[model samples]
Target: MYIEKIQSPANLKQLDLKALKVVADETRKAVLNRVSKHGGHVGPNLGFVEATVALHYVFNTPTDKLVFDVSHQSYPHKVLTGRVSGFLGDMEAMDAVSGYSSPTECPEYDNFEVGHTSTSVSLATGLQKARDIRGTKENIVVVIGDGSLSGGEAFEGMDEASELGTGIIIIVNDNEMSIAENHGGIYKNLRALRESKGTCEHNWFKAWGFEYKYLEEGNDVEKLIEVFRSVKDTDKPTIVHIHTEKGHGFAPAVENKEAWHYSMPFNVENGSSLEGPEHESYDQLLSDWMLQEMKKDKTLIAVTSGTPTAAGFTAEKRKQAGKQHVDVGIAEEQAAAMVSGMAKGGLRPVWTVVSTFLQRAYDQIAQDLCINSNPAVINVTGGGVLWMNDITHICLFDIPMLCSIPNLIYLAPTTCEEYFAMLRWAILQDKKPIAIRIPTNGVNHTTEAVDAAYGYEPKYKMVHRGSKVAIIAAGSFYQKGENVVRLLADKGIDATLINPRYLNAVDADTLDSLMTDHQLVVTLEDGCKDGGFGERIASYYGPTEMKVLVGGVKKDLYDRFDLQQLLSDNRLLDEQIVEDVMRSL
Candidate 1:
C-alpha cells in the first residue's frame, strides 16, 4: 500500500522517516512475493532495499550518478525508479522488469549493462571524471559491496578517486556476500569490523586514501538518511561501510543467507520455494561430480572467484578438499593467475564461475593460462544469454572469443550427459586450457543416446543434409536447429543442421566439404552477434565468397532481450531460412 502512493523518486521526497520505514517494509514484501512467484535474487536485493530507497530519496537520480557494483542488488533501484510497479505492482506484470539494472530497458539506469561485480567504483570514477571535464556538478555515488573491496579494480577506483579528490560517495553495502557468501583476506577484515561493532583496526579504505565511516543498523531509514546527509559532499572521496543482514525484513532469508541468496519462486508464508521439487543446480552437479572425480586424482584442485557457495561446494567440502579448493574472494584476476600457478605445479585445476563474471579474467585466461598452454578446466555456468537482464558480458559469446585465442579450446555442452563427456575429454586433454560453456537447460535428457551425442554424433555432425540451406548450430541452439530442420522437412525443403561442439576447432574440413554442396551456412548461437558462432564461420571462410548469415544479440545490452526479435532481425525464422534456401536453389 505504501508502494502504491510512491510513484517516483520525486514522490519519495515528500515522505518522512516514519513513512520511509513503512515504504521499505512494503518493498520487502513486494520482493518476497515476486521471488515467491516468478523467482529471482533475494538476499542481495532485500539487503539493499532501504539503502537504495534512501539513496534515491537523498540524491537526485537521472542526474546524480549511482553505479551499482554487481547490480544484482538493484532490484530495489528498479522498484523505486519507474519500474517499481510491473514486477512489484502485483503478480500481473511479474515478468515485466528484469532482475538486474539496464540502461537500455529503462531511462533510470546510468551505468554499463551490469551483472559483473567490482567495476561500479571504476565506472563511477569515469562518470565523475567526465562530469568534471564537462563542467557539470552532480552527486556521483558508487555503492559497492564489501565483497567487492577485495577486487583490485575497486581498490584502484578508490585510490584514483582519492588522488582526484573527487567527492564520490562509495556506499559499501557490507552484507558480506556478493552471491552465496564471500572469501579472501578483506572479508576477514569485514567480519572483524562487524564483530568489533564497526571499530576495525586495519582499514583497507584508509590505505586506499578513502575517508572511512561505518554504520551498524541498515534498516533504520532515519539513521541511513542521517549518514547520507552527513557524508553527502565532503572535499575528498569517502566510503560509508554499512552492516546489514542479507534478508533484513524476512525471517528465513535473514538466517539462510546461502540458500536464499537467489531463489526460484518460493512460498512467502514460510519462505519455502514454490518453484518445485528443488532439483540440484548445475553448480551442485559440478561439485558432486568434482568430488567423485577428485577422489581418484589426488592432483585435482578447484578454483572459484568468491563463489564456491554458488558452485555448490560447502565450506566443509572445500575444507575437506584442503588446498584443493581456492577461493580468491572477489578478485577474479587473482584467481586466474592462481589457477595458472596450480597448473604450473602439475595439478589439474578447474575454475567454476558464473558466465558473466568470466569477463574480468580474460587477460589472465589468454596471457597467463592459455598462452602458456596450461592444463586447466574452466567451467562456465549460468550461461549469459539465458539471464540477459544481468547484462553479464561473459556467456555463449565468450566461447567464440576465447576460442579465437590459440591453444584455448571451448567445449559447449547442451545437456548434462554431454557435459560429462566434455569433462572427460578436458581431463585427458593436456596441451591447452579448455573452458566448457554450460547451457541453461533443466535435466531433460532421458535418452541413453544423449551421452552418445557428445562423441558418437560427431563433433560436427550434419542433419538432413540435402540442399542450399544449412544451419551451423553451436552450443545450446542445437534444439532450435532441430526445430528448423523439422520445419524444412515438413515443407519438403531439406535444411542441413551441423553441431559445432568444439567451437574453436570450427571443423573447416566439414564446412568446406559441405559448403561445396550447400550455398549458405547460417550459424545460430545464443549470445552476442559480433563475436558469436556466425561471425567465426564467416571469418573462417574469409573473402573466399561465403555469404553467411549470423544471428544473436545485436550490440547494445537490453534488459528484456527478446529472442524472437533477434531471430527476426537476423531473418532467421524457420520459414525465412526455408525461403532463403528456396531462393538460392
Candidate 2:
C-alpha cells in the first residue's frame, strides 16, 4: 500500500501529487478501520487526512515544527509519520498510540502532548520566539480549526503572532463544527469568507494583521500541497483558511457529524456502535430534570462551553431549551463569567461542564461566582477516575479546587436521587455558588428523597453508628463505606459509616460527637489525598482524641492506571480499608 511505503515525512516528500493522493485514500481507510474496531476520533481524523499528507509533503517536520490545536486531527498525521501500524495493523498496535498527539510517543514527530482546544497558536508562538532567541530559521506552523478561534487564548496568540513579523504559518482548518455545530459570530464571518472566496470586506484574520490565503478545495491533495508550499518559507505570519468537510469519506459520519466527532467502537459496514446501550448517565438525569424544571420556571438557564453534548444538552434539547440554553464555544472562562452574570441578574444559571475543562475558569469561579455569592449551579460531570484514562482529562482535582473557594457549596451526591435533589436545591436557593460532583459509576437510585430544604448548613448523614471505628465516606465513595461495614461485620467488628454529602465544610457538630464514641475516624474520598475532602476531616480531628486516617489517591499525576489497581493502591477497596482499619486499631 502507498501508506506502508511511506515511513516518514522524508519518504512522503519523495511521492508525487498522485502518489500522495493514493496515500491519503489509504490513510483514511486505515483510520476508518481502526476507529470502527477500537473507538477514537473519527471525523476530525478523516477530514484532515489529505491535509496532513499535503503538510508532510510540503514542510520538513521535526526541524520545521507543526503544532495541531487540540490534536484531535493528529490521527492522520500519526499514520503518515512512521506510525501506520498504529491504525492499519491489529487492535494492539492501535492501543500503542494515543488518540491525541503526544511528545512522549515521538518527540520529533509530535512536538506537544495536547488534548485541549485553542492552544496551538500560543504554543507555536512560543516555539517561534524560542527559535528567534537562538537565531534559528525553522518554520513554525499551527493548524487550528475555525471552532477554536472563539477561544480568548487563540486571539491572544494571534495578536502576539502578528507582532513576531516572520516564520509563522497559521492553518485554519474550517470544518464548521466544534464537537457539535459551531457557536458564536466568528462562524458567520467564516461562512462569509468561504462564500466570498476569502475576499470579504470584514475579514477577522486580515483585521488581526495576518497575510490571509484561502483554499476552497482543502480535501484536494494537490491544492493543499500548493497552498502549504507557498507558505513554507514565508517571512511573515500568514493564515491559510481552508474549507474542509468533517467526516469527508464516510457516509454515516458525514450525515451525523456530531455523533461521529468522537466515537465508540462501531460496525464498519453500517457505522452502528459495537458497544451496548448507554446506561442512564448523570448527564441524562440532569437534562431530563432540567427540562421538567424549565417548564415550571422560565428564569432557569442551561450553559455549556463548546461541549454541549458532554453535558447531555444535545441538539434536540438545546432547541427545546430555546433561548435558555447557552453554548460559549471553547470559552470556559467566558462561560463561567457569563453564568455568574446571569445569576447576578436574578436568573437561575446552571453551567454543566466536565471537571477538567472547568479548571480553566478557576479564577472566574472564585471571583465572579463565589465572591459575589451568585447562586449559579456548576454541575461537574466526569469526576474522579474514569474508563477513558488520559492524564489531561483526569478530574481528580475538582474537589480540592472547588471546596477551597469560600461561599461555594461543593456537594458530593452518592445516588441519582441525591444528585437530582441537590440540583433542585442548588437551583431554588439564592444563597451561594453550588457545585455538584457527578458520580462516575452508573445510576444508583434510592427510594428515600433527599432533603429539598438542604441549605448552607454542613449536615452529614450518619448511616450507621458504632464505637471504636467510624468511616466518613465522601460522595460516591459512600458505597465503599457500605462495603467496609459489611467486611467489618464479617469480622464481627461493628463500624460506624457516615456519608459526608458536603465537601466544602465538615459537619463540626457531628464530627465532635464522633470523638465521644469513636477512637479511629477514617475519611474516604475518591480524589487526591492532598488539599481534598479527606484532608479537611483529618485536619478537623487533628487536635481531638480521635485518630483520623485519610484514604484517597496519592497527590500525583497517574496516567492510564488500571481502575481496580488504583482503588487497591489507595486502600479504596473494602478488604484494603478493612486491613487498614485493623492495623489502625
Candidate 3:
C-alpha cells in the first residue's frame, strides 16, 4: 500500500522509520510478484529491498547520483521511483519497466543503464569526478555487490575514487554470494569483516585508502538510515560495507540463494518453477561431456567467471570437478587471461562464458590468449539474439567482437554432433585459442557423422547443393536456412544450402565454388550484420559478380525486443528470405 503511494525517491524521505519498513515490505512483495509473473533477478532484488528503501530515505537521489553496479538489484529502486505499476500490475504492465536500471526508464533517478557486473564503482567514480569538475557537491553513492569486488574494473574504480580526495560513498552489499557461491581471496577478507562485525584489523576497503565503516544491520531500515546519514556528504571517500542476506524476504531464495539468484517464472507459494521441465540444452550436454572427459584427463580444468551455471557446472558438478573447476568470481577479464596461463602451463583449460560478458574480456582475449597463441578452449554460450532482451545484455555482437581477434578461431556449431566434435578438437589442438559459439537455437541432432577433423581447415559443408541462389547459414541460422530452402523449393527455386561452421575463417574454395552455379549468395548469421560472418562473406565476393545478401540483426541497440520481430525486421525468416530472393531474381 505504501509502495503505491511512493511516486519518487523524494517520497521516501517523507516517511518515518516505521513507514519506511512498511515500504520495504511492500517493495519485496512487488519484486516477487513481477519476477513470479514473468522471470527476473529474484534474489538480488529481494535482498536489497531494505537497503534500497533506506538509501532513498537518506539521499537526494537524482541530485545525489545513486549508481547500482550491474543494476540487476535495482528493481526495488525502480518500484520506489514512480515505476511500481510494472511490478504491481499484470505481466503486460511489467513491459513498462526494464529488468535492469536504465536512465531512459527514469532519468531523474536511475543514473545508468547497466546490466553487467562490477561496473558501479567505476561508473560512480566518473560521475563523482564530473560533479567535482562542475563545482557540484551532490553525494555520489555506488551500491556494488561483494561478488562484483572481484572484477578488475571495481578495483580500478576504488583506487581512483580513493585518490579523488573528495566525497564519494561506495556501499559494498555483502550478501556473501556472487551469481553462485562467492570465489576469490577478496571474499575471504569480506567473510572476515562480516564474521568480526567490521572489527577486522585488515580491512580490504581501508587498504584501498577508503574510510571504511561496516554495518551489521544492513537489512534494518532504521539502522541503514542511521549509518547512511552518518556519511551523507563527508569530505573524504568512504566505504559503507553492509552485511545483507541474499534472497532475504523469499523463503526458497533464502534457502538456496544460487538457484534463486535469477529465476524463471515460478510458483509463488512453493517457489517451484511454473514453466515445464527444461528441454535438452547445450549447457547440460557440455557439463555431461566435460565431467566424462575430466575423469580421463587429470590436467583438464573447467573455468567460469562467476556464472558457473552458464557453463552447466552446477554446485554438484563443481564439487565433482573439485580442484579442477575454477570460478574466478565475476571477473571475465581475469578468467580470460588466467585460462591462457593455464594453457601455457601445459594444462587443458576450457573457459565457458556467456556471450554478453565475453565482450569485457576482448583486450585480454586478444592480447593474453590470442597473441601468445594459447591453446585455450572458450565456449561462448547465449550467442546471437537471445531471450535476454535487455539492451545492456544483448548477445548479438559476439560474432564481430570475437571474430575480429587474430589467431582466434570462432566456430559456430549448428548441431550437438558438430558442437561436441568442435569442443573435442579445440581441447586436443594446442595450436591456437579457439572459441565455440554454442548454438542458441534449440538442440538439434543429425544421424550423419561429423568429421573428427572438421574444424582443422577453413571449409563450408554443402548441405543441399542446388543452383542460382545459395544460403550459406552459420551457427543457429542453419535451421532457418533449411526452412528457407524448403520454402524456396515450393516456389520452384532450388536454393543451395551451405553450413559455414567456422565464423572467423572464410572458406575461399567453397565460396569460389558457389560462384560457378550460384548467382545470389545469402549469408545468414544469428548476430549483428556489420563486421559479422555475413559481412566477411560479402567482403569475400566483393570483387566477383556474385550478389551477397547479409542476413542478420542490423547494427543498433535494440531494447527489450521481440526475437521473432527482430528476425522479421532483418528479413531473416524463411518467408522473408524467400520473398527477398524472388525480388532479387
Every candidate's lDDT: 0.75, 0.87, 0.90
Candidate 1, position 100, lDDT:
63
Top lDDT: which candidate number?
3
Tens digits of per-residue lDDT for model 3, 1-585? 888988988888777778888898989999999999889999988989999998888988888999999887899999999999999988788988899989898888888889988888889888988989999889999999998888898889999998897999988999988889888888888989999999988888788888889999888998998999999998799999999999998899999999999988999999988898789988888888899999999899999998998889999999999988999988899999999999999999999999889999999999999999999999999988854678998898999999899999988888999899989989999899999999998899999888786555688888889999999998998998999999999999998999988899799999989878889999999899899999998998999999988899999998999978888888877888899999988
Cα lDDT over the full model 2: 0.87
Using lDDT as the yardstick, the better of models 1 and 3 is 3
Q: State each model's C-alpha RMSD to the native.
A: 3.7, 1.2, 1.1
The best candidate by TM-score is 3
lDDT of 1 by residue, 1-585 (tens): 768666678889988888888888888877777778877888888998889888988888778878887776887777777776755656657676667667766756546666667788888888888888898878889888877777898778877888888788889888876665676777777788778766778877777888888899876788898888888766578889898878888888888787788788777899865654667567778788888888889888888888786577886778777777778888778888887788888888888877767777889888998878887888877664555443454354566467667777777776677777787777665767878887775553535443332332235755457776787776667776777778778878676777677766667677787767676777777777776667778888876766677766565645444657656776666677657655655
Supply the global lDDT for candidate 3.
0.90
TM-score of every candidate = 0.87, 0.98, 0.98
Where does model 1 exceed 4 Å of error? 8-15, 56-64, 78-83, 87-96, 103-113, 130-138, 278-281, 314-322, 387-396, 444-471, 486-497, 515-522, 539-556, 568-576
Clashing pairs in model 2, backbone N/Cα/C closer than 3 A: none
